[model samples]
Target: MTPVPGDNPTPRPAADAPGAPAPGTAQPAAAGGPLRTGRPKPWHVLWLLLLLGWTVSAADRSVTGPVVTWMIDNGVGFMAHADHPHALGGLIGGLFFAGYMLTQFPGGYLGDRYGHRTMVVVSLLWAGLATILTGFLGGLIAFIVVRVATGLGEGAFYSNDRTLITDNTPPKDRSFGMGVCISGLAIGITIATIFTPNFIDFGRSVLSDIEAWRMAFWVLGAATLVVSLAVTWFFRTHLKAATVGKAALHLGAYAVVSLALIMAVYLIGDSTGLSDLWIAVLEVALAVGLVLFVLVRKGEEVGPVLKDRDLFIIYLCNIAILWNLWFFSFWSVSIVAGAAHSSFAASALTAGFNAGAGIIGFPAGGWLSDYGLRRGWGRKEMMLTFTGVQAVLTVAFAWYLSAADHPSLWVMGLLLFFASLFFNALQPVGHALTAELARPDLRGSAFGMQNLIGETGAVLAPAVGGALRDSTGGWTAAVWLDAGLVVVGFVLLAQVRGRRAVSPV
Candidate 1:
C-alpha cells in the first residue's frame, strides 16, 4: 500500500519484536545519529471516531434493558400470561446475543480482509436503521426480527472497532487506547440511565397517546445515525487489509455448533418430558459448546502467545473481572429493589449504584491501567491484583447482605463503589493482554475471541443468578453464588505465569 503523500513511510520495529524496549526504557541512539524516540504519533481523530462508534453500539444494545418494563406496560406485551413473561423475555433478549455470537468471527475476519474502518461504518448504519425500525414496529415477530438485525449490526461494530484500535495503536499503548474506547460502553449505559427516564417523561407529557418507550427508540435511532455519519467522516482510510479464509472457517464452525446445540435443546425438551433437569442439561450443553467453539478457534494458530505464563494468568483474571462486572449489571438492581424496605429507597439505590459505577469507576479503571503501563509495572500483574481484591470485596458484601436484617444504604453503597472500581480496572488489563499475545495480523481475531469469552459471562450470569435465587429463596444466595464464581476466577488466574516482553509506546 502506498503511503499518503505527506505521511512518513519509515518503518519502525514492531512493538512485540523479540527485544523491544519496555514502556519507560530508553533506547541508545546510533553513533552521531538523531535519537530514536518512542512516543506514538497522535491519532486523536481516530480515537474520537472509535469512541463515537463504541458509544452508539453500546447504547443501542443496553437501552432495551431500561425500557422493557415500559414496553410491556404500554400494551406491547411479550405474552398474555404473567408467569411466562420472564421466559419469553429471556428468549427475546437472548436472541440478540445469539445473533451477536453468531456473527463475531465473520465480522472479525471481514474487518481483517476489507478494513476495520469499512466494516465499522457499515455496521453503524445498519444497526441504526434496524433500531429505528424497532421503534415503529410492534408484536413479537417484529421485535424478534429487528433485534436479530440489530445484533448482527452490533456484532460487526464491536469486532471491527476493536480491530481498528489494535491496528492503529502501538503495542505499549494498545491497552490504554482500548480502555479509552470501551469506556464509551460504560458511558453510554450511564447516559441511558440518566437520560432515558427524562426522555420518556417528556414524551408522555407532550404526546398523551404515543407510548414514551417508543419515543425513546426513535431518539436512540436518530443519535445512532448522527454517530454513524461522524465515524464515516473521520475514519475514511483503510489502514490494514483483512484475512478471509481463517475468519470464514472460524465463523462457520461457531454457527454450526450454536445451531446444533439450540436444536438439540429444543428437541430434547419438547420430547418425552420437560423436566427441570432436562432443561438444565440443555443449558449446560449449550454453554459447553460455546466454550469449545472459542477454544477450537483460538487454538488454530491465528495469533502468537506471549511466552510469559503470567500474561496468560492475567487473561484469566480478566475473565473473572468480566464475570463480576456483568453479574452486577444483570442482578444488582433486582436484588436491591427486592430487599429495599421501601420502594422509593430501592429505586434510589439502584440509580445510585449505576451512577457511581458509570461516572466514577469506569474512568478510574482506565486511568489506573494507563498509570501502571507508563510506570513499567506489568499490566497483567495490575489486573490480577485488582481482581483478587474484588473477589474479597464481593465475598464480604455477599455475607453482609445475607446476615443483615436492614443494612444501611451508605454501607452497601460503599461496597458497591469498591466493586465497581475493581471491575472497571480490568478492561485495560484485558486489552493489554491481547496486545501482548496477538501478532499484528491476527490481532482482530484475538481481541474478538477475548470479547466473546468475556461476554459469555453476560449470557450465563442472569440465568445462573435466577436459578440460585429461586432455589435458595432470596437474593442472598445469588450474591454468594456470584461471589464464589469470582473467587474461582481468581484461582484460574493463579495458574498463569511469565513476563511479557515490553513493547514500545
Candidate 2:
C-alpha cells in the first residue's frame, strides 16, 4: 500500500541506539551540553491528546452501565416492567458491539488507505455527534439505533490509534505510549462509574427519572466534541488533504453500508421477535459475510493479514478478553449492587474501584512489557501471566458471591480491583504483541482485523452473560463463565510465539 504523505509509518529504532531514553523519562543532553528544551515533541503531543480522546470515548461507553442500572432500579426507561430486563439491557450492549465489530476492518482499511489522522478525526466527530443524538432521541428503538451508530463511529479509533502511536514512538517505548494513551479508558470508566449516577441524580432534580439519564449522555457527548476540535486544531498541519467529494465517495459510502447491515439485524429481530441469542448469531453471520466480501474484493491485500496463524490466535484470545471486559463494563454496577445489597451509589463506587485499576494497570503492564524485553522476556509472557492471575481472581470473586448471602462490599471491591489490574494490563500487552507480529505498512489493517474478530466475543458476552444471570437468578454463573473464557484465552495465547526483537531503523 502506498503511504499517505503525513501518515507514513515511522521506522522503529533499536533500544540500544544512542540517544534513546528509558521508556518514560526524558534523556539528558551530553555532559556539559546545553539543556534541550522547547515545545513538547509531536509524539508526546499526540500521546497526551489521544489519551483525552480515549477518555471521552470510554466515558461515552462506560456510562451505559450506570444509566442502565439506574433505569432497572427506578422502574423507568427501557428496562421498566420488562420480562428478562437484564437480557434486554444486555442485548442493547450486544447490538452496540455488533455495529462496532462490523466496522473494525473497514475503518482500519480506510485509515490505512487515506490517513490515520484523518480517520481518527473523523471517528471522534462521528462518535460525538451520534452520542449527542442519543440524548435527544426517545424510546428503546431510537436509543438502540443511535448507540449502534456511535459504536460504528468509534470503531475506527482503536486500529488507527494503535497504528499512529506505533508509527510515532520508538519500539522501546511504543507499548508504553499505547498504554498511556489508553489509560484514559480506565479513567473514563472510573469517571463514569463514580459520576454518571450523580449526573443522573442531578438531572432528576429537573427531569423525570426516565429522562434523567439523558443528561449523562449529553455531558459526555459534548466533552467528546470539544476534544475533537482540540485534536483537529493540534493536528492541522499533519492531517491528510482530502476533497469533500472523495470523503463522500469513500467514507460516506462505507458508513451507509455498515449502518444498513447493523440495522438489518435489528429490524429482522424486532419484526420476528427473535431471541437475543439468535439476533447475535445473525449479526455474526452478517459480520462473516462482510469479511468474505472484503476477501473476494481485495484478496491479495487481505490475504497477507489473514495468513498468520499466531495473529489469528491473538485475535481469538482477544475474544475472551473483550468478553470478560464488556461483561463487567455492561453489568458490574448491577453485579455489585445485587451481590452486596448496596445502594446504587455505593455499588457504583465499588465497581469504580475495578475500572479504576486500569488507570494504573494499563501503563504498568506496558512498562513491564518494555522492561521484560530488556530482560529477554516478551509481551506474550506478560499477557499469559496477567491472564492466568486474573482468571483465578475472577473465579474467587464468583465463589465469594455464590457463598455469601450478602457478599462483603469491601472484599468485593478489593477482588475487583486486583482482578481488573491484571485484566486491564493484558490489553496493552496484547496490543504491543499484535504490533510486533504485524508488518509496519499493514499494521492498521492487522489491528482492525484483530478487533473485527475479537469483538465477536464483545458482541456475545453482554447478552449471553445477561441471559445466564436472568436464567440462573444470580451473577455467580455469569461470573464463572467469564472466568472460564479468560482461561480459554490464556490457552490460546500460550500458542503464540510473539517476536520480541525489533529491526533497527
Candidate 3:
C-alpha cells in the first residue's frame, strides 16, 4: 500500500504496519475471539442525548471561569479582594477543577460497576443542584463550596459517557461518534461565553445586581435538571432497564453518605467554633472517604489498567494537553480582556470564535480519523500528527499573543481559530485511541484513571496561569509555560504506542 503522506509517518507503530484496520471498524475483540461486528446501531439517539448532557456539563462547569472576571470587576465573591485579583481569580477557577479532580476514579468505578445511565443521572442532578446553589451562595466560602461540588458532580461523567458511546458505536464510527458526543463541550462553552453575558444582562433587566449572574446560573441549572431527567428517561427506556433497581440503591447510598457528611460538617463547625477550615476539611474527608470506599469495593479491579505503562503515559499526556486546554478555556476571557482591553462581551465573542472552531474541528477530526482508517491508515499515526503539530502551534499562539500590544478582537479571534482548530482535532483521536487500547470491561476504569491523572492539569491550569500572570505581570509568561507543558505532553504521547498496534475492530 502506498503511504498516506499526511497522517502516517514512516516510523509508525510496528503493530499497525501490518493488518490493522483503523478502529471503529470490524476486527477481533481479542486474538481469535468472535469477531465484534455490527453495523452502526441507531447511534444518533445516544449521541444526541450524551451531547445534550455534555453541553450542559460544559456550560455548568465553564460558567464560573468567565464570571470570575465579572466578580473581580464587581468586587463580589472571591473578587472582593482588590489586592490579589489574579490569585483570587485563579483560586476560583481552580476550585471547580479540584472538585472535578477528586471524583475521576471513583466515578469511573461506579459507572463501570453500577452503570452509565446511573452515573449520568447522578452527575446531572449533582451539577444542577450545585450550579443553582452557586448562584445563591454569593460569599467566598459559599462560592468555593458550591463550585467545587459542581466540579465533583461533573467529574467521571465524561469517562462513563465515553464508555457508553463505545458500547453503542461500531469500530468504524467510533471517532465520529465521540466527536458528535463531545462537541457538546464546544457548543456549551460557546453558549456560556458568547451568549451568557447577554443572558445575564437580560436577567438584570428584570432583576439587577447579583441577580443577573445568579439568574444565569438559575436558568442553566434548571435546564441541566431537565436534561438530566430526559437522559434518565431515554437511557431507562432503551438500554439498562434491569439496572434501574440497582441504580436506586446506589443513589440511596449516596444520599445517606452525603447527609451524614453534611451533618458532620455542621456539627463540627457549630460545636467546636472551628473556622470554615474544619468544614472544608470535613468535606474533603467525605470525598476521600467515598473514593476509598469505592476503591475498596473495586480497588483490586482497577489494577490491570493501572499497571499498563503505555496507558499511564497516555494519562500524563492528557494531563499536559488539558493543562493547556483548561488554561485557555478558564482564562481566555481574561486573556482577551487584557490583550484587546475588551469588554466581557468582546472577550466572550473571542472565546466563542475559538469554541466555534472546536464545534467544527471535533467532528472533522473524527471524520478524518475514520477516513485514514478506511485507507488502511492507523489511529496512532493520526493522533501523533494531529496532537504533536497542534502542540507546537499552541506555543506559537502564546508567543504571538504575548508579544502583541493591545491586539484587536479579530486578530485574537483569527489566531485562536486556527489554534483551536488543531486543538479540537486532537480530541477525537486521543479519545478513540484510549478506547481502542483498553479492555472492553475496563474502558470506564481506564478512562477514569487517565482522566484522574489528566485532571491534575485542570486543577492546576487556572491557578498556575493566574499565579504566573500575577508574578510576571502578563499572560505571555503563563501561556508560554502552558505551551511548554503541551510540548512535554506530546513527548509523553509519543511514547504511547498502541497495545494492539493494529485492531481492525
lDDT of each: 0.58, 0.81, 0.71
Better of 1 and 3 by lDDT: 3
- Clash pairs, candidate 1, are 112-242, 112-243, 113-242, 113-243, 309-497, 309-498, 310-497, 310-498
Q: TM per model?
A: 0.77, 0.91, 0.83
lDDT of 3: 0.71
- Alpha-carbon RMSD, candidate 3: 8.6
Decide which is better by lDDT, 1 or 2. Answer: 2
Q: Tens digits of per-residue lDDT for model 2 on 1-505?
A: 2212222223222211223332222321211123247634445667888899899998887787788778888888878888888888888888888888877898788877766777788888888888889988878888988888888888888898988777666567778878899999899888988999889988889888679989999989999999988987766654545632353257657767877888888788868998776787788788888878888999998777787899989988988988988889889999999898899999999998899999999999888878787777877888899999999999899889888876898999999999999999889988988988887677889999999988888888888888888888888899988988988888888999887664322
| Candidate 3: residue 150 lDDT (0-100) | 78
Tens digit of per-residue lDDT, candidate 3, span 1-505: 2221111112222111123332223332321223236522345566788889989989898777778777766766557664657765775666567567666776776777776657777788788887988878767667766776677778858888887777656676788889888889888888887877887788778877765777778888988999988887655532354565565456445544454454456456647865333343444455556545655676678766666777778887887877877888888888888877778888888878777788888888988887777777777778778777777777777877867766778877887888788788888878888887787778888888778777767766887788777777778888888878878877777777664344345
Residues forming the 10-long window of minimal summed lDDT in candidate 3: 1-10
Error of 1 at 460 (Å): 1.7
lDDT-sorted candidate list, best first: 2, 3, 1
Decide which is better by TM-score, 1 or 3: 3
Give a tens-digit lDDT track for model 1, residues 166-267: 555545456666667777776666565446666677768765544556676778888999998776655434322233234434444544555455445644
